[model samples]
Target: MKFALNSNLRPLQMALLGSMTVVAVGFAGSAMAENRVTYKSAKAGTSYYQMGVELAQAMKEGTNGDVIVTLEESQGSVQNVMEAPSRKGNYVFTTPPSLVAAAENSKGAFEKKPDEKYKEIRALFPIPSLTMHFVTREDAGIKSFEDMAGKNILVGKGTFSANEGTKYLNLFGLDGKVNLANVELNNAVPALKNKQIDAFVTAGSFPSPNVIEAAASLPIHVLSMSDDQVKQTGAARAVIPANTYNGQTEEIVTTSLPVIAYTTTEMDDGTAYTLTKTFWEQRDKMAGNAPWWNGVTPEMLMNVSGKMHPGALKYYAEKGIEVPATAK
Candidate 1:
């Protein structure tokens, strides 16, 4: 082993090895930050859309723009989940276990047929629970779902929120009797203020922006759903604490569901892991801008529909969180 190295060969070998190291590191870095991705949320001005915007910004900041997320406004939860897996790297926001269950089985609003893509959607994180808001004017004389028979009612437009409204109407046996109006959340406010509709139903995280705005302008009453009503309707029980909004004194017992972020299973593990980590790291920052993000916890991230992204699972496991067995 006492051989002398060739003067010329040593420099060449050193340069070659250095170049290989640089190339390997470059490829790994590139893989860490894939190209831009589209994040689908409910129509603009909705809580989903707001969350999408903050998520996109947080992901960008965390990755230093490596993972660029574009906010894509979608129709609603059912539509968002249905359309989410249409493209790779596209993500969606869904509330309540019901919507995800419906999308996964192609039931309820998704009753056209079974979609294989639905099975491939994976949960990423839980943002907030969507609170149902049954809006009516103080003078509408509508005390409950029973009182809305034969009156014009505004359900949400092209979102799972709207589907839930219709389900409630049907559950109360007022489906055919009431004049159902499918309109956007913002537009529904005017219809209610102008007396164009007798009652309107909308939903989002507590302090629903539209509901707050509507209540500020008119003598609005957010009707309550009894525990029995929610149980009968198959909606998760929720309570809107008194004074959550101006003029709202009494607590509103209603149904609600957690909103989860999801992505297609086809996303690379590295990208998924990076995105998930970035979201967790910047969550406090995101919540500072959007209060709806304040209540996230390890428990909230568990018990989601469909499988969990392996990347996300790895992160959760590191945090000592329990993922559902089915999802794992």
Candidate 2:
């Protein structure tokens, strides 16, 4: 048998051969690249989610598009802390330090039994301080936390907001005196308008969407906390900033807790180091998207109460930034 190829067929053969070569190269490049890590964040539009999107984009850019990251929506800080440590996969999460401490100690929100796996969790970075907002109707005449006595309030339905609200009530000796209306945040504004609830408490990044919406429709006031009480709760003093809401002229004095990014101890040093370095180097790019990402210095990221991921520590050390003794 003889095979004859016309001159016109030669070009087609070469083009097909070139296409195959390109596909082979592409596959080889994909195989050599690092696996994409899953980044867990809160619901869309929330500060956590916004920051997560920014960080993932920055990581992808810093890694020359080799280290891909995908975001998974979650139940925000409290639940994220409880589940992230035990979840299997190349994953990172955001949660408050108080919840991290709770998960480690197995008390407070976690009950008396601590989740031992939580001890394996390592700090990556602290995104921002989540300030507590106690919003009430201006007509309610609730001038302070103590004035919440005998008034119905919504602290969120089985959320971290509720947990913290209870803590605040107890701290101010208004626990039994205040009537907590077990209701979700979505119901807060309606309940307030109907005069069913006197106030609602939410803790998150400044200008909370729910609070803003409620303020637009009603006369709202954000209560302040005393410095001594903030210290007792281990919360940093923060301000809501003037004009965060309508009629909010003066900065509202409040307390805040740090929201941190974390990973499990099983994440290898090289990957962790690269991720930490990539995030740190690309932070300026992410700052414009979310107020929470602003001014996130390496020192703040390393100010965690417990030990940090060795990879993160290594990256900071390379930058000549000293890690805090408590976070070692």
Candidate 3:
């Protein structure tokens, strides 16, 4: 094939080819500009997972599809933080600030396999907190932490609630005095109804579905902690306002652990900025649909443990939000 004389095309043909090349390049650029982030949270059916879905939808709507968020089911906060070392490119996960601090220090869950990448993890924004709920049967006669001394309490295994509940009991001097039930949290309401356990502890955002379900089926009591008790736990204080659930008359003051969305240093500053801005801008809209979102506020940033992502920091600064010195 010796076709060497066609070195130059006609002016119109050359112009068309050049225009097509420009169009092709523009399409490529547009694709590159589209940021796709993977959002990992809790199990598929949990409240936290639902929040992830809502946040994904909000991100899409707020960014006009520029920033597309894909949701991934996570086992728990510990798993979320553990996977950070190997995850790549715009991966965001939710976890309590304490767990992030643990990962950074190579303590607790990360002690067995510490990763240097954990230090690179950065905070995005706070999400709804995990509020502790001490639910009891109305007839159980257990109203305060002290009254639970002789009760059978189910604090599900391998969760923040279980660990914190055990700690609180010990801190309150109950120790081996209480009969701690060894069972899953899913059986809590049924166990209580059957008189198998006097009370159970759960940790979630306020108006927890499990609490609502229990309250709806049977008369229940939500225990309130004293100011001194809350301070002793060294956790953030949260209040479940009265009438939040059926038969819930008085507000229950409780302890809370703040949860936050976090990303790694690998994410570009622009994408992080967009994600953070979109989250706050759409928060009210999300809250209108899911009450859990209502718990999130700018002030909760003080609870974030690690340094803020530079991109997220940029958005916060623009809004004049007060970021904690520890997270700055």
Put down candidate 1 lDDT per residue, 178-205, tens digits, no spaces: 9887556668888889998887887788
Model 2 local distance difference test score: 0.80
**Comparison by lDDT, 1 against 2, better one:** 2
Stretches of candidate 2 exceeding 4 Å from the true structure: 1-26, 43-47, 62-64, 75-89, 98-119, 295-299
Better of 1 and 3 by lDDT: 3
What is the lDDT, from 0 to 100, of the residue 61 in candidate 1? Answer: 87
TM-score of 3: 0.94
Ranking of all candidate structures by their lDDT, best first: 3, 2, 1
lDDT of 2 by residue, 70-178 (tens): 9989976776777765687567888777777778887777885566788888887777667789999999999898889899988876666777877888888886898
Q: Which sections of candidate 1 miss by over 4 Å?
A: 1-35, 76-86, 89-118, 141-143, 146-152, 156-159, 173-186, 295-297
Name the best candidate (by TM-score): 3
Q: Which ten residues in a row are the worst by lDDT in model 3?
A: 1-10
C-alpha local distance difference test of each model: 0.78, 0.80, 0.92
